[model samples]
Target: MNHASLPTTDLRARQARRRSLAFLLFVLVALAATLGGPVEPAVKLLDESQLVHATTAAPPVEVAAPMTIEQLRARVAAVLEREGVPGVGLAVVDRDGVRWAGGVGLADRDSGEPVTADTQFRVASITKSFVALGVMRLVEQGRLDLDRPLRELMPDVAIANDWDATSPITLAHALEHTAGFDDMRFNEYFSAADGAAPRAALAVNPRSRVARWRPGSRESYSNPGYTIAGHAIELATGESYESFIEREVLRPLGMPTARFRRSPEYADRLATGYDSPDQPALFRPIWHAPAGALLASPRELAELVHFWLRRGDRGGPALVGPEALARIERTETLPYLGPDTNYGLGNYGDVSHSARSRGHDGGLPGFLSAYRYFPELGVGYVMLLNSTHSLRAYLEIRALLFAYLTGGRAVPPPPPRDPDPAEVAAITGYYGYESPRMQLFGFIERAMVGISVRPDPGGIALEMLTGGGAALVPTGDGGYRHWREGGTSVRLTRGDDGRRILVGGLTYFEEHSYAWAKTRLFALTAALLLIQLAPAWALLWALLAGIRRVRGRSIAAGEFALHAWPAAAGLAWALLPLLFMHMARAEAYTTANPLSIALCACTLLFAACSAAAVAEVVHASVARTVPLSLRLVPTAAALASFGMTLYLLFHGMIGLRVWAW
Candidate 1:
């Protein structure tokens, strides 16, 4: 048996078997890559600016001077003119009533129609606040219970939870986005059919409704959660969610002008939305009608804010009691995040303008709106913008309002208090984002937002995945009470998997070991470099193959398959996402659409080609005689393609049907 390593034929046969086994493994991986789910990541292909979100600091801007109502209006006009914002609606409120409510700038640019207090704009996610109000109203009336499991209420709606026995999904969990459901899928995002009921939104993509974690354990914002709640409202009452809101919540709170659909009144006074000052943003009729489809003016929003200020009392028998209103503002689920002041029912707690504020920031495509109320000071403001890119203008307007409201009595945060070295060491590590708003984009969020807590002389430096960091100084009670920017804070705990966790104000981060961090770094570097360079290598081989054929020189079958298949694989990889992005922008691209079918087909084809390319490489290495130079690039291409296939397989994206998924 040891006769100088046996005969060459025996050795060759053994190598061929190993090659066959590897090729079979590649085929299995290829099959696995074609089955991705339908969750959406909100890829807006029209505007190029939002594609990059580099650094995030506290949104509130500090001001040096207080202003009168006249000064605030003048400053708003200046901001609109300078920043090229089409229009803005502002409402200021105190304990007594709305102080001022109106608009500044043109509502319709072409006709020069001036914006007024009645010019309605889409309030996007601010619609959730109204949903909470309706639920609380129902809760008080003894029709709906927040504590009852969703399964018992609506047995028809599809929901999958692993912990159904011990902890079932409740109305409170869904309203708070703690039901552990994934956000709406790609097809659901682009499902823009008009007059579709709240129940219709449920059928868009039900597979995404499966819980990713235990119910009520964490908070991840989801539009579908509110829509589901809307359907539940329909089940509880014999009418639609809009009808219920209008009857029980809106009219009772004295906001008769607000409507979920584009009624005749809403259409007449609706402000034209803008991507910028010059570019008009067309209205999208997405299925998240309950979550993001409220059309209300600054004046209507004033009434809504006043309802909160008055604590459910409207001068006639109290609609919803003070305790229910208090429960709406309290964060009871995630005690680790902010205890009593985080994302409660619908209105989240904030510390903008040096004040503890409870509000909601509504951002969709065309319109952006905000509702910030200072409960302690008995004041609040609602600001709405027609243009999506007018965040700076919004901030400026708020800062001016903050100055006028505070009257130079804003309390500054305590400065530079460092924790002990032992405490810093206990908390320092690589922490990954665990609870992502959108499950589809969780990978990207994990990569970009991962933080590293390093000990500093005065405090600890909180460094992000993308390079820059902030040196955080501990001020309040030590351990997790240390304040970062704004009202953001962090605490250490354990995830359900029992991994050490760093719980922040809005995000949950699980600790990553040092070895895992190094491995991830290496993988990231390899993926970035290879995905870019593999195509180049394929391109070079393509040119050579073309030249060989032109000169009438016969190319080997093994060599041709090795290079050619990988080139096809690379091309498919590049075009699939681009095609999806372009297709997603329009309403034509539904799950049943041909383009959606084609996209899935292309993804499957990509995996097949990658598998074939790798199989050829293995076969050639064993049986055929290819030069090192000829084999190197093609091998890299095959490996790179295979790596991507593995990624797709791992993420359940292999047979990704955009429309159906």
Candidate 2:
């Protein structure tokens, strides 16, 4: 009876298993049918002839046809929607005149007011071009000379230059940003009292007036230098820079709306600038108006661009003579700033894609603008945006417009030149500039953000220790072009002291020994890592000691203090910057803020604590009270922290007083 029952049960189990597998197969077949089968051939391969043909074939044709006004408008609207730009005003000018002029997005998002062609916006640094026009007008009148020493013309203007005996700063140097002056420091720029005279505004930071290098030797962008040039205009013409520019330049070009300040007529029509959708930008008076502070509508700015493209061939009123305009358009060859680009009197010159273009870009807290003119093509563009987001959108649009204007011919980048290994090695090093423009903080910036140039297979790569980086490619000339940034380049030159000087965009950096930079970087990295990890290690050690105490062992007071100091120092170092950031969010943190004072105090205290911790670890290592393993970690941490503190001290950050500078 038992044998029969077992055989029956095994036969029933085998049948059930077969039924289950059959059902699973049916479900998989149903899923495959529902999903649909692949449409194209799954395994297609090209023959040898097809492969060769594909490799040798020309590239696909690009969209080179000129876009209609409606098409351009649609594209701009798409970009505005995608970028979340609040408002933008645009004007495109051809040889005949404005091809199209209009606005996109909202002038006031809350009010639902659409931006119009006549809506005014802050043009920021584009003001430099107008100021340059004023200076050139004076030059044509023989009231000023570009090459004349500025001090000779405006004796009252106090500028200190140590690199040269004569303190030679010229009008051209000031206009071209080659005066060797440092940029206005945080305090000088933000804490400047409104309604101050030009001289008084400059006096706000006397140290910034001093040259960081010899005048006309290197190009460094300096807003304060432009202000000084504006003052020179006043001295030469006995008229204010703004008044002269308005009467002679703006009025002549039929751009009466283009002025340095908010006039009554254009006040209500001004676009509301924004830092973001939620953050409204408040008005801050620009003391250095000549550097950046122009307000104009897109149409008015296009008028100014038209004047340049015509090369002073204004049918009615001319702002500058043909000869002066030529001088303004010609790019300088001496004291080079870039390989394919140069700063003209009040304009920037660039040869990219085999086309030479002149224009300027402007930026401020909540506004960004650009005006470019391709003289050969007799085409120009003006872009004004009320938001800083998507700052590069205008540039991309410019490129598209240029391609269409050029009949779709691709303007390839300059051919890369083979770099000499020896030359590359000679230039590969760390370079730093003393940013005396930032005053006290400038010293700290120089130490923390030095430029590092490393040799590479193609050429050299230059990087800022603080953040941004660029790849350098040799440009056939004895200079290197930024592989991606077409208009920017660097030249290697010798300083007055016979040391290697790297001349980039608007500043010069003196080369530093690789050995020195490497050691500093290693010490900095080690210290940063140790300080960041101090609190975690300290807590772990404390926990372990507590476990020992629970097992009937107690740690000495000396040992406890040794661990405590590092934790305390680390917290202080980390918390201070965090606190500053918190204040910065509230718009309460500034160079002159009391929080800066507290930061300085905490930094110095941390350094002191770090020094004590180093001593304690050294003593512990010598006494051999702790085991070798325990001693090693503590010793390394202490030494790293101490080294960082020393570096900070050397850079004037440990006990720096922001207000004093």
Candidate 3:
């Protein structure tokens, strides 16, 4: 028994040593990579010489009557080439049926397979329109109620509604994206495989199920909300969402090639998606299929568009009554969020210069598609592409096609709103919205996408610090309309703290002390870089000490402790990105993951280490043992590290458990 205990204790000791060595090695490797040069991405922008054949000339001012198919093909091809899209499928629909259908480029660049009218492309968010139609069909059949609270219908489903009694989530709210649910988190979005069922996919990450605000109070685009709606449809009809939609909606509407699941028969016809003309993208199926997972040929999409143009009538089985169709066409608006322009039930409503248009545009990682119908003109258009780079090209094609069909010029640009320099100046500052839902990474999230309001010609420009910029036109009601996109506006209000709060398009940005926070981040980054040099510093110091000892000089052992603790703290800082890279690749970077729990622990350890380092530096500084110049660097490093740690703590990044929230 004593011998057995001795062996077990030895094994435990060995395991502990192994773990310690593994951690040390990991830290060393992470520091090495961090010090490595920046990584270069695969795709690079093409130069002007490479774009010579892409037809960068201006579009023709007008086209002759009864435009030939060759003319349309040439124009589309030019746009696709110019935009670097690998392939595109187009369908032109009129009152009778699909008038013309064709494709312009390669479906599979490797195989050199040409895209055709029947080649299927992921329709992305356009799948929402189909799901909306399914819900309306159920409503028409008296199987589901649009206004009824979703909790009432699917009692088995778990949804956290803080406004339970006051405003429960309704079917309408889910369809219109006013359900107050957070958008599907990172883990939920990329973790699910193609075959995962709707409810199973949602179960992977349930943190997003909790309402971020009161249901129906604001409109936010939520993919999970629509998946819930689809689940509700299955519960209501006692049929799988796909089967019901296929039989009642797709079959009746003559959209035979349109379906959620990828069939083996159509695999060859499916266009290969690409991140760029040369880079093939993986076919990642959307977990929330009801929101954006349908693959359809341009002609198939055109058929659906044609049916909608006829207003719930396809001369066969009526999908929904005309009244229900009208309701679907009606756009929803909130007092603070403004009108969700052209955003109806899975559709968008808009008035161009010549006709009223209703349709939806969809974009995934490697695909973009648009389906727009002008009911007044009795024409519909479907454009599907395998690359997202084609979006600008697709928009231009839509505008040009509309102009040709309606015999009118492109929609006149909205007149610019008069400049209010005073108002602009007053609002010119940095604003941030920290989402309580983004539990662990809220600090980085807020910092990355903060808003900057700057003075512009019209009134002011609201620019996302990360990238996108849009002009804001004064609406004179403490509101401002988006310059390009009508029906979308932002309302500004003064919070009790005297900070201005901007409410727009399902998001709110409160004026933040961005300057102070930004300064701290810059300081922290500089300190971290310097801290990464600690290993080199230690090695040099050890070498010099050994040389001195060989020369009969004594080395001070106490000096090791003075440098060791701070170096250890610096090592922790270097390890952060390494841990993040591991999690991000697995699509488990969200707070829901166990790895995120480890990350929070690391953050706490870092904070403690930083504090200890600061205390050590202060003690040395007071003792006057270290040179002032040497102390200055370590002092700054420790202070910056402490500030960053505090920042993370205050912003709820440390020890945050999103699942509990």
Candidate 4:
């Protein structure tokens, strides 16, 4: 299994997207789970002592052959121990049967329960696998049209899109994640309405369902897309999403233990999920089960792998024809991570093993899971972890399992075929991401993940804003292949959109002065931070001066005015991280919550304070009584603060109510 997630599809709560959003957007990532949904909680790692994260690149993987089953288990155990993971449940399978199904380490630190094959772990977004199968079943039965307009299917559901008349949303677009929808807002991410209808779950924030661009234009990983699909399933089948999936997908696969919700009967059977070694992450009900709510054992997940390898068939009538199943595993939209790792329906391709493969990776709260297989190779594996902090360990263990399954044998890359000169000419330019997984932080992300493309002798050179460059060599067809490390993932393509958009690995980027955006935004940000330092130092000086005045020493009132007001503004801004860090545990990114309200109010307060400071700074600077250097300090600080206000105003961040937004 290829364990690493695509930058766009990767869960945001606490992992890849969370940290980035937090860093660029007050690292509010600590505010909740990852960007995809509740599964990827975005927590600032305070308990670093308990969970050593994957900050550095993993050790190089080798495809050494003839690795024994015992060796595989040993290696995985060593990785877990080294990385301080509590436990994991693993299952390896081929067309024949399961080669292994077991667990390692402590399932519960307090209880001393070891992880076992039957230990139930929340599979997070991998629940979508069942939904995908269910949707495909409906397609097979001619009940749900994959390409029919979603508006026609469910007129009751409201979705705002300017291009609705031109490009309507469809079931295939939802399943494929090309519906052009923004992810759920902060409030929606934390919605824990147990037993709520799928439609009601969506009604938490209908505004989030608005499309940033035309439907089916590009793919951005969306948690609610799956949720919306669940609602459509209910409409089509005259059955609830949870009931229908359990009856049609799970039972037919003989996964008796697989379920959508928690039950008292399965209490002891569940693994204790953890965010840290001593700190357990308690399970909370999420609004939509289709997005990330499935709970299953590793043994049951093994059956899921078998179902995929068998081409969506489960012993009896095939859930989907071989052709439809094949369609689900092939990427038609932009690349997710690379050409080889493009996303299909609920499934995505993975060539990290140097062989053609299809699978899904998921995360939520204290759990992480992956379901993968090389259909052509007829082998795959399923992994479920009870801890979220052990990504380094996760990657290493996944690599080892693949080595054991494939005997370290490699597959060759396909022969190269360059795009037509006209096509290449049209695509080579700067582009910015229109699809922000977190809409509140969209402007920040545009600068973060934007890229500049240019024609290269090989094919195209992709330069991302956050460092790293790739040469996309063409691999026949219209798609461009991307190779990184020893494996290839994702692809770059001008997608199904009529706009002739330049599309590639992750996010939906449109032509823009992305380089200019990155350069100007960073420049302004740096200038503001640097300017704030003067006021920060002035505040400290003012504190000492105030003490001296109390002791009967004289100091100029002009200097105090210059220092205090701008200093207050800087301090107010600085206080946010500390306050946010304190509130991280509460995940207070919602608008209704007092803390969330305060969070937004504080930003405006900073602006208001900043505006007031500018006038005081002007008066202070013109005062002949104040020293020239001291006068200069607050003047520069005020200007920077004012500039920042305009920038924030332009991007609509001034009065941002994160949760409601």
Candidate 5:
């Protein structure tokens, strides 16, 4: 008849009903927003930059040549269909004017509606270009210059190589991404607070990694560069990044829909992006304001492109002079292109090792967008999609469509095949991934490899390794290649030893390689690891000292034992794993995350706890055994003291010192 035995059937049913009703209400609200929202105008301006006046009126629009327009539409449709793209919005601009504009498919597939030209898709990293343009606006005003030392603008700033040479980084370098800085984008936005606090630190103080090249010596595409650019823009304009962009770029371009909201207010008209169903939601309050955090419909962005195409001739003074626009478009600085790539100010120029067009391709966790303009043919295209698969499809379709627009031929490639035997054998091995924040090793079993991600989920996330691994054909050279669905590529590098292979910066361990023989030696040495005894010996010395200090005292049995071997053994066991793991590591980089060190420290603490418990059990000294028959309490309390010591130890080991040094 107690509370536990009470029936409470009505209360339980009511609670269940409430949960069900709440869930249904959420679904109904979402449905209402998607299906009942008002249809916005095809080209609505949500905001524009007020800083740069748009003195000129919108340039007269031009219809494409009949043949050209038809070809462009058909090509766009084919690309969208082939790639299973849910929807796309395109803006074509040339020297004459904005030549063609349109949208295809549904912006929201779940809503079962077609994408209007105005359906805003988050433009992802294209926001970086806008940020750069804002900085240039200040330069045009004579408020800032291209070559002034950044330290002068904001003293105590520590951008990598900011003040190294006579020709230090200028506004030009910041705008063009030639500032010798490593690419680091702010990711604090993924948190609930959207990383506001951390972002504040990032804005106030920018850093550059120690570089092999000097500032502006070689270009490296850097998100951190844009973040610094935004910071510098703030200093120049006396505004936050958000206010500056709102006042300078969006207000002038008449882009009212663009905003950096933690949650999109126009969720109904705004296309929702999806990675997997459960991809972690990312928040970036700092980054959302600039580098990769703006959202606008393709239709809105088309107007933005048109504005840029017209060189700011929209009823106001030019947002950017024709000369500055030309500078941004031209290759004033080159991000050291790999064997097959090149980048200019916030835009990739020669992505395919060819000179077909200029634009930037943005790919993040749940977004993909490509904004390009072909000045030669006076045709440009903007492709924005919600799915992760959208980029490849968008690029492929765009490339083929470009051929159609340029009067060139489009020939599709052949299908996939089983991998070559030699090629498969060549890549078979254990590979080590040594990034700054992650250290993992994977072993190839036949064609598939299993990776162990320590202290977290340890398995493959994507079935498609290399994305096109199973489809690749081996060339005469040992390397294998595949024409990825997008304008993307993959290449494998082999060592001169002819056995070692490095894929995606990871070293593959091969069974047939000369290094294979060392595995046996490794196993043998592991079995004979008396090497850990050194730490054990040290622990024993400390234990003996504790015993001497407590000589002749009627210490509790648990306390006496804690003054004996438990503390020593605990320290030894903890150091054992860390030592072996360190032996296996190659080098540490600056970008390493703090979690890696935390895992190792946790191991040490757990070992200490185990040793302390064992000592207490052996001693069995306690006044409370009659109640709970416990033996470890006194020793556990002693180890708790060590546990507190370890908290400090861990922080020191894996903190700012590890990085700042």
Candidate 6:
């Protein structure tokens, strides 16, 4: 009998069967987890210094004595250490006096150079306040009007079409954020352009730039507008913007250390900014100067604040008249920041934890700074850190200010309300919406659950839930509206079956009906199931196996596994959505080892496939001296692979959730 004609134990069929079994095993593992299981938080890699702060309260004790300069220095130093900030400088000002001016930590951590009160730091956007003062000074000098058209000073500048109305852009418009420009443009104006020539380029291309809204129609903070306004002061006075500012504002106020230069004149004491502890060398001074570029010592900055506290008076011609200075204090809507906040001229005013406060925050390459004053409590604070992670520093300063000045009547943190059970139940289902028309919907616990929305060609999509109601997130308007699509409206209808939701033109029957509103979670679940081969690694691997077998006389299991390794990795990729969903859904599940499950699954799958391929070779062994007993080895190997796969599946599902729960 010719070997070609002999009934061939099909190796391909055996391999396919093995792969099918592997897939089934994968599904089983996923199904076990999906059905119901314990969940836990996944492990993460973080530095030892990255503190996990708990919501701990200070023990009952008398409020500390009125904070002295010495007390402030020690407190600030401790805070810098706790935050891993390389260094910091703080200045405290009051109605009658300045106190607690000092710095802490190494200006150069490696060199061990200590930071001092005079150590210079790029004040970042706090420079905007100085620029604002300069602009107002020009206004005081009758060189510019706050409410005049910016186009008048810089003829090349393109004023927004909306500002063409008789109420042309004015100093007030620039100060109040009514100029139809935005933050980054202002940042680029100063930082992007080194000197006058590049700034002149900005004046010509104003229309292509992004604006928060039409000028005077909305309250959008415009950083570029201030820079432009600063330019206008230069244009009108025939003086460079920096020179004009120094002559008009900082010089008159005795803030000698303050200057806007490409590089600090005194680099020895300048605190080197840091991106992070690990990334120590990401510092560059390109287009960062206008918005956050000016360098000043804490003492100089404190004096600047003192000038404002003294109502811009230096016994000579005031930097700004009472009326102009008052504009800096008046609240204007802060659309760029948030609806709940406002800015007056260059200063920020907001209600934090429900207490009214005023301040400006600045962040740049490696520095963060804030200067806030509570007029009601007769206190002010300045915080400057040589690291980007300055939020902790900001909070510490706020806490200190609150403790010492507000008689320890801390602004109460917002109370947590138990989630709406009925709403949760209604929003537990999935829903969808369209885009451009840019719509999205999702629900959970009978209320809206997930908010992750992706836009499709015509609209957007949401997940499914049990309830009929779904949220409609409109991408066009940049706000979510609750409405019914497909023609139905959201109105509660009482029927013989009880109350049901009617939304997007469809009346969901029984509130958990098939035609209920879709949600983000439901969309995501459906997409994951429908599009399981996304990495396409599995399909790609199978195809490659076929191609390799055709291309060569034989194939190596190791080679096949090498090419298909990415597919093995895809098994884990497929489970990520499910893992995240379970994590979010079951709050008790604090940690889940997705990577472990993936590794075990890949190994089991790869091993089973390899065992089958080995068996195929063994069954048709050329030597035939390979005993029938060896065939039993393949069976045993298969059984072991199956057993391991099952174990991983069960643990991945039931064990994780059970352990976490």
Best by lDDT: 1
Instruction: Look at candidate 4 and tell me the lDDT of residue 275.
Output: 79
Worst 10 residues of 5 by lDDT: 48-57
- Give each prediction's root-mean-square deviation over alpha carbons: 7.2, 17.6, 8.4, 11.5, 17.5, 16.1
Against the true structure, candidate 3 has what lDDT? 0.67
Q: For model 1, what is the C-alpha lDDT against the true structure?
A: 0.71
List candidate 1 segments past 4 Å from native: 1-66, 81-83, 190-195, 310-317, 335-341, 390-397, 407-410, 414-421, 475-488, 495-499, 540-561, 587-589
What lDDT would candidate 2 get against the real structure?
A: 0.66
Quick one: how many clashes does candidate 1 have? 10
- Candidate 4 has its poorest 10 consecutive residues by lDDT at 47-56
Q: In model 1, state the lDDT of residue 53.
A: 18
- Of models 3 and 4, which has the larger lDDT? 4
- Predicted structure 4: lDDT: 0.70
TM value for model 1? 0.83
Model 1 lDDT per residue over 40-158, tens place: 32322221112101102443465655467777777788889999988888888987889889888888898898788888988888889888888888888888998889899888888
Worst 10 residues of 2 by lDDT: 41-50
How does residue 643 of candidate 1 score in lDDT? 82
Off by over 4 Å in 4: 1-66, 191-193, 312-317, 331-338, 412-429, 454-461, 470-473, 477-502, 539-557, 621-627
Question: How many clashes in each structure?
Answer: 10, 2, 2, 26, 39, 76
TM-score on alpha carbons, each prediction: 0.83, 0.80, 0.74, 0.84, 0.51, 0.55
Task: Give the distance in Å from residue 516's predicted Cα in candidate 1 to where it truly belongs.
Answer: 1.6
* Candidate lDDT (C-alpha), each: 0.71, 0.66, 0.67, 0.70, 0.46, 0.49
